[model samples]
Target: MARNIVISGASSGLGRALAIEFAGPGATLGLLGRNSERLDETAARAREKGAVVRSAAVDVRDRDAMRSFLLDFDAAAPIDCIIASAGVTMVTPVPGEVEDLTRAEELFDVNLNGAMNTIAPIAPLMRRRRAGQIVLFGSLAAFAPPPDSPSYAASKAALVAFALATRALYRADGVSVSVVCPGFVDTPMAGSYSSWKPLMMSPEDAARRIRRGLDRRKAIIAFPLPLYLAARCQQWLPDSLRTAAMLRFRAVQRLPVR
Candidate 1:
């Protein structure tokens, strides 16, 4: 197990569950999230499990702040694992309606650039030590881009590719990189979607699987065998057929009230 770990998006959903799952005696956790109160809650839970926890209410999209937070945490204790799990999702509001470009841009900023910010700062440090693990959170949508959430799917697909390339590049340095492509998870984010969610998993179960995958240094940790297979299969279908099939499951994402 990684003794010193850093996780972004640690306030809620799979990220929060992962933090709790990894917490225990001899572990040190550095957590980051946008919500201060919720981040504190996560830290408290980790502390209860006997892990030393440090938390920050910082947005992953701010590169400078993320770099500072990651570097400071690493300086205090050499980080063994870094999980870039911060992301957001949006969809076309209705059939034939294009998504707002501003919203799409914001989604990309969070899902893709934010992940880059979270990983870039500490990558070299880990390489110098010749030890570290990096995990990027992707989604099943990467395999089969959903019609309703084009930007969301594209962002995740880009992450999957980035993870693959980075994994290869860092392998020689003893730094391991893994990407997680999960199906629907019963998170508040997922709750916004009203479409049928096949094989939806609880955050705890998802976290356990992710932890196990990281322990083994697996390159890609996709879950729910059925959904994974189905997504992969969609890639081989004709473009029109694929799009039509995806339309059947189209869902509108309800933005949370501020």
Candidate 2:
């Protein structure tokens, strides 16, 4: 039997890639995104691949709406895997400039609280059944604070801890939780970065790796082995050396116009 999957942020980027990667006969997909046009496009593409797709233009930050969408989808087709991939990124300010407070708040709201809204409600249902997987999309940025985007780093860092704790809490209950900390994946989201992104992998490739990791039930799946190793080693560097190395990591884009 094909697995039933739910993915937040399915309008584009890694979320859309994963939707395509998981699409096939017998597979049922529930996708939630903030853009109706793009969400519909994604649904059409997945349907082409023979997957039964249900999509909604819904914001992950809207707790009630998200809860309703997730619960309703679960009732229709019990979700085997629920991936929290909806997120927004803020670029770092140029020299002598302060980070935008509003952008920072929005960052936390979407990347952190929004993720919680997307996955938390579904967790208890999965726990009760003792069957299901919850996957949180983290980032390589979580390993070390980048000089460019403090809030972005903080948000992902929180998820790293949360994902691990959640995994430990539900492991014995047959509910598997995994955190995927991908390196620079070539997606619209990563395009927001103006600095050099080393060891970037295509969304398609990254999705394959994540799916493989999930299949094996790995608790944490961080990828592009070389970059993952570097992120792990970065924290061990001397303060001065790390600061100098991280100088190249600044974000150059301004806040998106409303």
Candidate 3:
């Protein structure tokens, strides 16, 4: 098991669940999130499990801040694993409507650039050490881009590509990189989407599955096998058919309070 773990977006959702799942005696956790109160809450829970916890309220989009935090934490205790779980999504409320440009920018900043910021600061360190694990959180939507949340799907798709490339690049250095593409997880993030969510999973269950995949050093950790398959199959359909199929799922994004 990885003894020193770093997780971003640890305030809530799958990130929080992953922090708790990995917490235990002899473990050292470095958690980063935008919300201080919720980040502290996650820290408290990990401490209860006898793990040493250090948390920071830092936005993943801030490259300098993320670099400093990651380096400082790594200096204290070499990081064994890093989970880049910060992300955001938004959808047009109705058919034929487009997402706001400002909102789409924010989504990309958080979902794509934010992930790169998380990995950039520490990847070299891990590579030099010749031992580490890096995990990126994508989404099943990457395989089947949603008409309502085009930017969200695009961002996740970019992450999937990034993960694969990085994995291949770092394989020779003994640094394992994995990407997680999960279907609708029963998180606050998911709650914002008013749409049919088949095979939705709880955060705890999602965390467990992620951990299992990490243990095996799998390149892609996608869960709810049926949904994953369906998403992949959707990619094979003709463009018109794919778009028609996607249009059937009505999703309204009700912005959640961070």
For residue 210, what is the lDDT in candidate 3? 98
Candidate 2 lDDT, tens digit per residue, 93-191?
655565689888988999999999988888999999999999998888899667777888899999989999999999989999999999888877777
Global lDDT of each candidate: 0.92, 0.88, 0.92
**Candidate 3 lDDT by residue in tens digits, 114-166:** 99999898999999999999999999999988778888999999999999999
Question: Candidate 1, residue 1: CA error in Å?
Answer: 1.9
Instruction: Point to the candidate with the largest lDDT.
Output: 3
Deviation from native of the Cα of residue 80 in model 3, angstroms: 0.8
Please state the error at residue 5 of candidate 1 in Å.
0.6
Give all candidate RMSDs, comma-separated.
1.2, 1.5, 1.1
Q: Report the alpha-carbon TM-score of model 2 versus the true structure.
A: 0.96
Question: Candidate 1: where is the Cα deviation over 4 Å?
Answer: none
lDDT of 3: 0.92
Candidate 1 overall Cα lDDT vs. reference? 0.92
TM-score, prediction 3: 0.97
